[model samples]
Structure formats: C-alpha cells, structure tokens
Target chain A: MSPSPEILTPERILEATEDVLRRYGPTKATVVDVARALGVSHGSVYRHFRTKAALREAVTARWLGRTEELLGELSEEPAKTAEEKLRQWLAVLFEAKRHKAGDDPELFATYGVLIQEASGVVDEHLLVLIGQLAAIIGEGVRSGQFAARDPLAAARAVFDATARFHDPVYAPQWERPEIDDEFRAVCELLLRGLRA
Target chain B: MSPSPEILTPERILEATEDVLRRYGPTKATVVDVARALGVSHGSVYRHFRTKAALREAVTARWLGRTEELLGELSEEPAKTAEEKLRQWLAVLFEAKRHKAGDDPELFATYGVLIQEASGVVDEHLLVLIGQLAAIIGEGVRSGQFAARDPLAAARAVFDATARFHDPVYAPQWERPEIDDEFRAVCELLLRGLRA
Candidate 1:
C-alpha cells in the first residue's frame, strides 16, 4: 500500500513532516507522528533525517527555500528598472509574509516557533535574502540610478529598515488598513535615499 | 514604620511592584509580594491598584515613561540643528535600549513579558514617543531642513523604519560587534532621505 522502505527519500519525508507539523503544531508534533502519517517506521524516518531536530530543521529549510526560489526568479526580470525591481521586491516580500500570516495562521505560528529553534537554518535563509537584495542594489549603482559606496551595506540597511512589514513579530499589524500606506512611505523614502 | 495605610500611595506601591517583578519575574510576582516588600497588606496594595493586571500595567507605563521623558528632553535642544538632533535622538534611543537590555538582564526580561501583557500601556507609550519625534520633525519642517509634508506620518515612518535598533524584539542583536556600524548606516540613509 505505502511506498517500500527501500524507496523512501528525503523529499518524501520532509513533505510528510510539514503536514504533520501543521496538523499537530510544532510543539506536539513528533517523529512518530510523521512516521504514522507516512505509514512507515520512525526508524525509517530517522534513516533520512538522523534526529527529530534535524528533521524539523530540514522541514524549515524546505519551506524557506521555496520563498528564496520565488524571489530569486523575481529579481531576474530584465525589463524593469532596478528601482522598479527593488520596489516590487519589497512589495512581494510583504505580500508573501502577509499571505503566510493570514492564509494559514496555525501553520504560520507553528513555523514561528520552529524558526526560533532552528536559528542556523533561519540565519542561512536571511543571508540568502540579503544576497538577493544586494544584487538589485548593485544593479542600480552600476546603472547610475542609485548611489551607494557599498551595495551590500546599503542592501542590509534597506532590508533592516523594512523589517516591520515582513518581520513575523509585526505580522499582527500587517492586516491593519494603514499598513500599506506605512509600507509605501518607507519605500518612497528609501528609494529617494538610494537614487543617484 | 513602613508608611501608614494613609500614605501607601500608588507611586510607592508601583515602586515596590517594580522591585518585586525584578526579583521574581512577571509570571511569578504577585500583589501579595509587592505588599510584603512594602510592609503593607494585600488589601492595601489592591486599594491603590484595583487588580494585579492594573498594577503590572502601571509598572510598565512607569518604566517606559522614563525613556519617553528622556527622549522628549533631547528632542527639545534649541541650539542644535534638526539633523544633529535627529541623529542624536536615534543614537540615544538605541543606547537606552542597549543599557536596559544589558544592565540587568533579569529585569529586562521581566519587563519584556510585562510589556507583552500590558499592550495598552505600550500603545500609549508609542504615541508619546512618536509625538516627540514629530515635534523634532516639525521643527525641521519649519527650518527647511527636512522635506515631509506631514510630520506625524513621517514620524511614524521613521520610528517604524529603525525598529531593528530600538525594538525589544531586536534587543539581543544590539550587542553584535557590527551592530553599531549597521546603526550608523541606517541612520545615514534615513537622514539623507529626510534632508531638504
């Protein structure tokens, strides 16, 4: 009925873990629950991810990886100016975070706890996001559209400055009617600061 | 004696409550403990503050009010240009947060929980802080040093933009060696954005 133990893969294990985490929430979810959902042994799950912590971290990574891929593709659009791309990037980030927070609040909250536990995974994810931000700032600098001595530093500043819109800590404020206005004001000011 | 019932004022009760919270934390601290600390009865404490929740909110407001007063004074410096005052205001706010988080970590953590439990107090605190920021920006607008049409809106934008430096959620990151540089970069960009 279920896939053979020999055919079990890391991707399949991670998929099962995500659903298990959402259903049970992060605190109550266990490796055995994931195994039960998959119709396999916990030992088989451990074969793919050595420990429960490791398995949880892998699930967090996979979830974050999807966002990274989507943003990475969005940054590659050649038709838009760098400023346009940067604005779009910020808006998309805020929307993604808002949708995640609003669409499935239970899973969003579960990941919030998981994020605190898997700091290494989160740190790596932040670095990738910053890298993507830096690339767009660098493009603007090269095109004489933005003026910054260090694109990386400017990128970090921009990212930190906009944290209110995307930071999970402020997710409750995301649904406020004035949130879009606040987001736009921050963006306008930052773009003016960056313009050559 | 430890002040008669007639003299057991709200201020004295709040002072005792702050000490008690620091010692036992927000979750464990009780009105009975505050009363004991002040050599008074629980009924006496309740007379000054009707409920445990009310007492904790008062303590939180008193703690936040001190910083608000300090920043309000700094923003009123008549001799300094608005830009200098703005830069100094941001730096001082960061320093106050760093000191609070570092000086007595136990107390800092106790208040962090207390703050969450007392959101109304925090919201009022934010409004006062934003008003102080708007006063400085209003001065800048008059002197032709900044370019915002609405000082209140700009004040909110500035406050939200630099949240990473002063927000309690980011208190742990304040001590990073590179945090100072990051602070400077964000301030520089923001000041540039505000310049006329």
Candidate 2:
C-alpha cells in the first residue's frame, strides 16, 4: 500500500504545539513532549523548528492564518448588512471554541501568548481585518443600515464582546451541549447593539 | 502611645489583600504576603482569617461589595436615558481597571473569575440590574427620547459591551486614560442601532 504523506508539516507541527500548550502550559511543554504527541521524533521537530520560540511562532502564525480565513469568509459572505456580517463573525468565533480539536493543550497555553503578541507586534493582519470591519460599519451608517457613529470605535466594542468566548472562566461553564442557547443570546445582543 | 485599636479591621484586611493580589497572582499570594504588605503581623492576620482560602473569600466579598457600590451609584446617577446609565457603567468599569489598588495581581486575576461567577451564582442580581436598565430603556422608547427596540435585549447588549472593559486581552490598548471618547462612540452607535 502506498504510504500516506507524512503529516509533520510546519502547520501540523504548530497544531501539535498548540495541543501541548493547552495540555502542559508553556513552562512544562518540551520538544520531546510535542514530538511524542505528534508521533514524530524529537530530531524531526528540530529539523523544522530550532527552538521552542520558533515553534511557538509557527503556531501563532497558524492561529492568525485561521483568523484570516474567517475574516476572508466574512468579507466574502453576501450578508446584506454590517449587522449580519457582525453576527457571522460572532458565529465563527463561537464555533472556533466549540470545534476546538481535542488535542489543543499547547494551543490553549499559547493562546494568551499569541493574543499578547498580536497586540504588541501591531498584528497588522488583525489591524487590517479590523479596519475592514470598520469600513463595512461605516458603509452601513452611510447607507442607513446602521447608526451613524464612529465605525472604528463600534468595531472595537464588537471585538470586545467576542472576548468573553475566549475566557477560560466562562468556557468551562459553556462546555455543555445546551450552551448554544446562551451563545445565541450573546450573539443576538451584539447584533441588536449593532442594528440601524 | 495607645495602639488605638491598631486601625485595622476585617475591611482593612480585605483591602490590603487586594493590593497583595495585584502584586502577585493567586499562586504566589499567601496570607503572609497580605500581612507583610499591610504592615501587620502574621498573628493579626491569622486572628482575622485562619487560612489563605478564607482571606481570598473575604477579598472576593470585598470585590463584590465594591461592585454593589458602583451599582448603587448608577441607580442614583439621575441619568435620564438608558444610554446615559450605560455610559456611566462603562466609566465605572474603566475606573476599576485604571485605579485597581495596591498593584493587586490576585484581585486582577480574580476580576474575570468574579464576573463569570456572577453570571452563574449571582444570575438573579445580574438579571435584576439588567432589568432595571431595561426599564430606563423602555421609558426612553415610549417618549421617543431614544431609539426604540426591545429594551431588555438592549440592556443585555449594554452589559455585554462592558465585557471589553473587563478583558485583559485589550487591557493595554483599551485601558487608556481617554477611553471615554471611544465609550461615548459605542453608546452613540448602540443608541443609533436601537433608533426606530
């Protein structure tokens, strides 16, 4: 039988790193720890990532890549109003939390670190995405699809509303299958807050 | 000189604990840490609280106590509109972050924890406060004093908007001295979104 292509690409490595981060935290996770989880040799990991920091960077890149995809989908979606797009984004975030791969310990540990780096490094892609969202909001205001106000400021508030989803404090309580109702309540509130 | 009761009470202990928490996270903070910071002996601290967990509970109580005070102030702020009260609540949260006392690390860490806890354990209180905000909103809608929408849902949106002020992810960027401008903008958008 033909061998399946090796799954240890840089992206896959980063995914494993995210799992390790979630399971063991940055302080405890090691190259061997990550390799064992990925079913690869420690030396194989070293071939692509020379240091833990390098691997972390790759993982962060992967996360941003995912965020970018969501943003792209948001921009591409045929939502008629900014409010609809905002709701779409909220749905994406909620699903991201819900659909988290089971092996996401390293990703969880690295999650905080990634967010901090994005803010500090002026995560340009995030800024671009924010700016795009703001533009849509501005268009909504001009088109009388939303209230006329500072689009950028409104965009920030919407982003903050999603922050609660990432919180471990609430995430645990939200693990129940029935929590979709609460999630819908939150999303509806944001949409109502954004309505024209 | 007379000791004059040493000028410390359970209240003072709780306040000092907040300071210690701001300096160190929950892991590093101990009753002794609070004691030393408060300029009191370990025996005095033990006299008031027998264990670290007890002290933490007191700290949590104090934090809730402060939130209650803020809620009281909002109720009496003479705000003519729900938007006005919402703006005031945003200001309260902003102030909490800006003036978190004694470099309180534990208090800081626990703030998010406390928020989540309130949602679950203190749902009645949260819902009541939200209901009150909704009443103001309903009044505004009736008089054409503000945008007309489902006041209860809008009230909930206002609370969710405050989630920004509580999130640490945007702490550095959002907790600026002049957040009032951005806050006002959000209020304006929400008001517009609710406009009939």
Candidate 3:
C-alpha cells in the first residue's frame, strides 16, 4: 500500500487536529488524540508540533489564514470599483463568519476557545485583514473615489464600525431576520462616508 | 447603637454583591458570599433578590445602567448641536469603557463574564442606547443638520461604525497612545457623511 501512504505530513496533522478539536473541543483535545486519529504514535506528533500549544496555535493560524485568503482575493480583484469591492468585501466577511458559526457550530465553538488562547494568531489575523482593507481604501483614495487622508485609519474605522456584523461576539445576532438589512444600512453609510 | 442601623436593604445587598463579584469573579460568586460581605443572612439577600440568578442579573443591569444614564444625559442635552453631541457621546463612551477596563480590571473582568450570562440585560441596554442614538439622529435630520432617510437605521450604522472604539472586545487596545487619533479620524469620516 505504498508504505502505508505516509500520513504524517504537517497538513495531515493539522487536518487531524481540527477533527480532534471539533470532537473534543480545545480544552479536552490533545496531541495524542490527533496522533491516534492519524494512526501514528504521540511521538510522531511531537516531532511535528513540539508541544500541544504549538499544535493548537498552528490550527488557529490555519483557520484564520483561510479567512485571510478569502478576503484577500476580494481585495485583489481588479476591474471592480473600490466602492463595489469594499461592499463585497464586507459582505463576504459577514457571510463567511455567519457560515462558520451556523454551518459547523462544533468547530466554531472549538475555535472560539482556541482564539481566546491564541491572541497572537488573532492579532496577526486582524493585522492582515486591516492591511487588506487599507489596500482597498488606498485604491479608493488614489482613484478619487474616496477623500480620506489616511487610508489605514479609514480602513481600521471601517473594520471597527461594521464589527457588529462580523465580530464573533455578536455571532448570535447574525442569524436574526433583520441582520441583512442592518448590514446593508451600515455598508451604505460607510460608502457614503468614503465618497469624495 | 441607634437600633443596630439596618444595612440590609436591596441597595446594600447589591453593593455587597458587587464586592463579592469583584473578589471572586462571576462564576465563583454566590449569594452566600454577598450575604457574608453584608453581614446578613442569605435569606435576607434572597428576600431582596429572589434568587442568585436574579441577583446577578440585577447587578449587571445596574452596572450597565450607569453607562446608559451617562449617555442618555448627553443625548438629552438640548443646547449642544447634534454634531457636537454625537462627538461627545462617542468620546464619553470610549472613555467610560476604557476607565472601567483600566481602573478596576478585576471588576471589569468579572462584569465581562457576568454580561455574557446576562444577555437579557445586555440586550435591553443596547436597545436603550440605540433608541437614544435614534432620537439624536431624528433631531439632527429634523434640524437639517444631517441627511438621513431613517433615523433609527442611521443610528444603528453610527453605533456599528464606532463599535471598535467602545466595544469591550477591543478594550485591550483602548489604552494605545494612537487610539485617540484613530477615534478622531472615524468621527470625522462619519460626521462628514452625516452633514447635510
């Protein structure tokens, strides 16, 4: 069977760790659990991650990285006006978070605990998101679409302002019937604010 | 001894509960602890609060009530222009939250947990705050100081937009030296958007 199919890659470990986390949550999940799922010894997991903390952090980074990649693509999409891009970007973020919260509640709850323990990963993720927003705002400023003097500040403001729709703290409210209307209203106000 | 000077009123019970919460945090705090601090029987506390959950919820509502009263006064200040009121209102919120998070971190941490457990109180607090914002926005629109179709929608947008400055989740960054500058930029952007 091609030497047991070599299932000890970092990617495999992370995937298995995610499963273990989803099953047992962050508090109860362990490297041994991850190793067991992969049919490998705990020593092999240690060889890859060094410690349980390292493995958890890697999982958090990976999860956040997926969101960054998704939003990054929207920020980079050419041809669309900055205004359109900003709207789409915020919409996607809200939708993505809602999906995560709604579609896979078990994994989402696990990540919530993991995030509290991995502030470094959360901070890095915020920086990347803010950077993407700044890039889009910079485009708007240069194209004379937005009149803001500081793109980065503007980006941060936009991020902060729409946080209710995206922040995990308000995740319970995201599924409410009026959430889409509320999201659109906030976006419209922001777009109006950014207009030159 | 002036007939032992009854100090077992509901107000006194709440005060003692707050002390107990500050000392032991939300999870470990109990009505018995509050009674112990107040030098009264737990039965006395129960007579005032009905149940431990009721006591905790009352304490949370009281804590949130202070902020609401503070902001409500600002919204009611008839002399100031809407723009000025909005500026002061947002500034005060950021300051108030920062002070709570900084001045008494132990209590702040306790309240953080309590607030999560007291969502009904929290939701009511948010509604009152938003209602006050809508009232202010309605006045601004009527005075021709701002251009907005729906005062409530505008108010919600403004609240969502400034959440980063005041939301408890971002309290850790509130003490950053540059936060004031960031706050100002957002206010400016929103004010510019609102100007008729």
Q: What DockQ results do all the predictions give, each relative to the true complex?
A: 0.86, 0.42, 0.72
TM-score: which candidate is best? 1
TM-score of the B chain in each candidate versus the native B chain: 0.95, 0.61, 0.93
Candidate 2 vs 3: which has more DockQ: 3
For A53-169, candidate 3 gives per-residue lDDT tens digits of: 888999999999999999998877779999999999999999999999999887788888888889898989999999999999899999999988889989988887788988887
TM-score of 3: 0.92
> In model 3, where do residues sit more than 4 Å from their true spots?
A1-4, B1-4
TM-score of structure candidate 1: 0.97
Tens-digit lDDT track for model 2 on B52-160?
Answer: 6667766665565666567656756663565566556667656676566326544555565544444443555566667766776786778676664577776776665
Error of 1 at B115 (Å): 0.6
- Between prediction 1 and prediction 2, the one with superior DockQ is 1
* Candidate 2 runs further than 4 Å off: A1-28, A32-50, A77-83, A101-122, A135-144, A147-153, A166-170, A176-196, B1-51, B79-82, B101-153, B167-170, B175-181
- The Cα RMSD of model 3 versus the native structure comes to 2.2
lDDT of 1 by residue, B47-109 (tens): 877799998888889899899989988976689999999889999999999998999888898
Residue pairs clashing, model 3: A161-B160, A161-B161
The alpha-carbon deviation from the true structure for residue A61 of candidate 2, after best TM-score superposition, in angstroms, is 1.3
Of candidates 3 and 1, the better by lDDT: 1
Q: Can you tell me the CAPRI class of model 3?
A: medium
